[model samples]
Target chain A: MTEPKTAIAIQGLEKVYPGGFRALQPIDLEIYQGEIFALLGPNGAGKTTLINAVCGIVNLSAGQITVNGFDHCTQYRQARSCIGLVPQELTTDAFETVWNTVSFSRGLFGKSANPALIESILKRLSLWDKKDNQIRMLSGGMKRRVMIAKALSHEPQVLFLDEPTAGVDVELRKSMWDQVHELRETGVTIILTTHYIEEAEEMADRVGVIHKGKLLLVEEKNKLMKQLGKKEMVFELQHPLETVPPELCGKNISLAAGGSQLVFTYDTLQEDNGVTDVLDCLKAHHILYRDISTRQSSLEEIFVDLVRAS
Target chain B: MNFQGIKAIYRFEMSRTFRTLGQSIASPVLSTVLYFVVFGSAIGSRINDINGVSYGAFIVPGLIMMTVLSQSVANASFGIYFPRFAGTIYELLSAPLSFVEVLMGYVGAAATKSFVIGIIILFTAGFFVPLEVKHPIWMVAFLALTCVTFSLLGFIIGIWADGFEKLQLIPLLVITPLAFLGGSFYSIDMLPELWRKISLANPVVYLISGFRWSFYEHSDVHLSVSIAMIALFLTVGFAIIAWIFKTGYRLKN
Candidate 1:
């Protein structure tokens, strides 16, 4: 099949500060049009650097980045006009009214004045009530919404949200998620870097994990889980036991909590021979369990494991 | 530079400066009044007429220029510095504004501030001593030229400065002292030959001489020479600022 058109194309992007600090190595990635791509990484993982370099906030030491077929360095105005960036920091003109800030941001992207569009954006972001209020007077979450409103005011085809909901409340986060969904519905390609793994799990169309300035893996969320998912079963004994019986020793089962509980870890993708053999071994050993529970690896666990392994 | 972008940024910056009315406008007006009261009255008594004009009137142009210079520089420097310190420059850098748009927005706002303060100081000086405008058009032209030149200088300063202290260092340590020693209060001709030669090295002397010539139609320096020097300073100042913006000096990593 032919490759899908890319909204953002990054190839061999690198950033090295003047003092010789290498923030990002050469990275090649393509973000498909109209998809929500979540970039997952730990702190100091060069996520912000990559985002800034792509957005032209930082000069790249070496790279070729194109947004919507416009080269970031050569056709910067066109490239930047086609993209909207919501920065990680809560930085706004303190004295500017929310309405003016958003409206002005739209105009900054060379958009003509459209009060109706600006109002709709403000209303969508729930900033209509605070339209006349100075940004300095808004709460942190409200300020973040203002940032989103500003980014959306220009109506760019691609949006880069750098940790958009880092310190936001749960309700607001959900609403923002809904907003992202709505934006995606409207065919806006969204790329976001998030510290909240659950958010990535819930909202991302695809997940790209970066570690130590390297792209570790990029895969579909469900596919990644299905391929790498592991399951663990725990049995709660009716009574505390002193040790695991010798008959159960050959099986991959271990005693826990002074032999009160038995634990078994197995691959979920295995077709057979997991719980049956463990149960058979338990029955042969005359082990009893009041209850049993199975747990599959969550995205959080997968993320932690990936980071640790890297 | 995008005209629309420049307008947007200029409007945004001007709104910020005007939002704090007491700080941006009233305080500068009040401060200029105080300078006229203290300097115009006390120093005017000690000295006689300068170039056939009252000592009070002689220093009026300089005092106004002083306010213009200091306020213009401070406005531009702090305007850019505060955004950098607050980390909001990222928003601007990421926006579609070209470097020229950014410079025009900042320098235009700074020049507006200086022009407003210059007018306020002129009005304040009017209350202390009677003054005459020999050439009103020349006076206005020089006033605008001075404000724009200093505002551009301030733009360069803002880009070069790392912090608030560094921002103030140039205006306080360098620009203020030079303006003071540039014949703001008296003619450089009154100084001895060596001191006069040294004062000639101060660039501000040309700015003040050009402005003073517009008012009294006579100055210690020739009008053509002062105009030429002001133009030269403006060209050099803008060249440096343009280069800084183009290269993103001290702004981008």
Candidate 2:
């Protein structure tokens, strides 16, 4: 079998500040080429720290990180040349025009002047019309697009977006995702961190869950969903009762609101999810239900559960 | 250092400085004119000559140097401080530009601004006193050197300062007082021997002496010593800035 090519390789990454705070703890990860990798984590989970370390913004306390075989520290310029980072905050020289900002960012990366490329990037981001306007005059969403334009100016092979849509509107969020998807198609490996689980579900080929500076799990998106997803069944009683009967106790069924409703939670991956047994017992006890409904756990539910567990 | 990066950054910083033209250019020009009015008219009649030049012309170099130093410091410090305040330093840090590129871009823009303002002040002074340049070449050279030195010093201050108030603290408290005490409006020779020696301890005194010597061809301090002090200041200033960049002080953390 051929060896899998890696775009980014990190081993035993650790970042400990001088004040005894361990921001990152021995993280090991490998990102494949041209893959959309989503790092899902809550606040203070060291997502930014990891990204900063890879981009050479933050010095590493201990670890090895290489970008396309270039060491992040030793070959910082080469490694940085291959990666474009759009930080979480909207940061740009406010007095500069949108066009100037993008072009200047390209120059900062040692790229020659390419007005044609910059123009196309602006048009793609819907910023062509606003190209001559000062960045301070732009709206929040437009400023966010300018950040994207700046990052893309160098034509980097790998792009890291830290919460690209944290405060964006719904339409822009979808459009941003589309742009990300399009970039991936152009052979750019994209790594993004988002609190929005739907973004990961809709966009990520591989999902890595980070909690409290630790990698909780990393797997293919569909595989992770298939492995951890659960189902819930709720029943409305025909007649309201003051209390639950002892029969449903051992089955893990919970009485809701004076026994008027019963709730059952089960793992969806199980062949026999125990819903049938619970219904059988209810029928055997002559309990009548007016209605029944079931719901499958979403990525949001799984994410919440994983974060809560950690 | 990438020249393209430096040019891009220089253009960006220049536009930023120019955007507040009323404050950066007009305010300084107006203040300089006012200095020529208040000090030149009031003191020129009392002190007949300073090193064989009219008192009005004598104070011109000191005033111009004062403006150059303060404006260079203000421009460079604010150039770096505002980006940090607006949280744009992260963008610069993550970019492929090296530290040297960043420093040169900011300091170059700052020196340009101060140099422009210094010329404006000199012209504005021309309207008041009949000024003559004894050595135009040396004058321009010292002007450029002084602007560069102070601009680099301002860059260091910008990197070290965390807040707008802190940025203002050094220029307002330390640099301004030193410039004033360095004898922009008066000659150090008029002071007592002990006081004159104490004033020599001020670095601004050398800058003023060098500038005054270029204009009058005579000065309280030797021209060579002034030039030497400015060179030493440049060396020390560059060293501190390079060290800060290497350590990523205030920039990274």
Candidate 3:
């Protein structure tokens, strides 16, 4: 068997289109077995290109990719068989039933027909009711579920969900989150790319930020938020203020909540982020607060700052 | 080899054909009946015998060959093309399959489809024409080869095509007209000396002539020459398909 820990190892991976467009720069990274790694990026950020390169959908210009110890190029069969990809586009055979298409995916991966496995997958995705229905007749959310079922049909070691919930509704997206959690329970290494930072924050154990064909940073999701996160202090006031106090007018302090609260934004990493000054000023102004709460910057804010700074 | 993969693709393609049985099977059979009515009944009544074979019997092999060739190209071309157009080709590309295995799945299904249609036409022709096969083995051989070879040709066309219109271009502008003028209805020998020599340049003439010979044991061209031409087309088709896979033409990039 291959390395027991590393699910995927990509070294010096690059993709240059025939038209001379450089889609991926030379990069090296490794994903550990059973970890959910979210590659976060905006549109045209080479996230899909990198995923496609490793999945054998796009031939790599240069690099080595090994999935479960099989080289993606030299041992493509073993490597690809171990990897399942749910592309962003909802492309499926309109005429085929859900069961047939999902079973067909298993066969495509070189697995023998296993009706039981297909049944289990369909049932898991809540698609058992629609298994016999044609793809064209299904709702968009159900089709997405079918795509996931197809990816899981072959019992792959690694699953790549490319923008899995790109246009999905909130309820379905929440259900999909549960599905991802369940897949994690089954010990499948999941790597997904998305511009939706909330998805990364909610689903990822680790997050890799890719921008302009380059991997900028990869860190534990919580650690990443803590490292770059800013602090926002909101004080619920007992009295209303028409505007910012003259003493706090030039500071990062503002009136909010219909003048019933005072908000302060500051850098958490700074030795002194003016929080004391703002508090002192509020006290001097005889501002009595009913409650005070601090909120850390979300992954979305950190991601925006990272992309903007880069 | 990914035997399961090939079987899956093959089964999927065949299922499509069965699902549209009217267009895939019944349509070809109906077209064959129409050809028999128009050419065999109407034209045969006015024309004299060629090489002592009745006009109705003379066109059977040609008709079958025509149907086989067209159906093979059409079936194979559409089978591959639809997956590409629909963007499901990504699954095929990402699958654990060699291009050869993929070719086998698609081309095998296409050839089988054309073969079935050809047999149906042959069986349907018997209802209208007094058919006789002097060499049943060669007839089967010719029919099988025509199906396989033309399907390979169609597979190539499917890959080379970027749009639906291009898929029909070669079959319509090239194959259909060539088959019509390839002595499917009349022998090339009945033409003027210069026209007969020029007709020799048309490859379909050899295909139709050789097919007709399997029934009546008479042909405008030698059977050996016809076999050689088919072998050449198969080699060319296989070579082109190999090159396509190697270069990743319209398939990968």
Best by DockQ: 3
Looking at model 2 chain B, which ten-residue stretch has the lowest summed lDDT? Answer: B42-51
Candidate 1 has which clashing residue pairs, if any? none
Candidate 3 structure quality by residue, lDDT tens digits, B1-253: 8999999999999999989999998998898889999989888878788899889878888888888889999999999899889989988988999888998899999999988888888888888888888998998898888888999999999988999999999999999988988998899999999999999999899888888888999999999999999999888998999998777788878
Point out where model 2 deviates above 4 Å: A1-3, A233-248, A255-262, A268-294
DockQ of each: 0.69, 0.55, 0.81
Error of 3 at A293 (Å): 2.2
Predicted structure 3: lDDT: 0.90
Interface RMSD list for the candidates: 1.3, 1.5, 0.8
Query: Tens digits of per-residue lDDT for model 2 on A20-135?
Result: 89888899999988999999999999999989988878778889999999988778778888999999998877778998889888988888899999999999999999999999
Root-mean-square deviation of candidate 3? 2.6
Model 2 local distance difference test score: 0.89
lDDT of 2 at A142: 96
* lDDT tens per residue, model 1, B88-191: 78878887877768878888888887888787778777888888889889888888888888888888888789878899999999999998998888889899
Residue-wise C-alpha lDDT for candidate 1, range A1-310, written one tens digit per residue: 9777899999999888888988888899999999999999999999988889888888888879999999998899999998888999998888778999888888788888899999999888888989999899999999999989988989999999999999999999999999999999999999999999989989988889898788888888888877777788999998887876777766677888787888888887778847898888778777788999988888888888999999
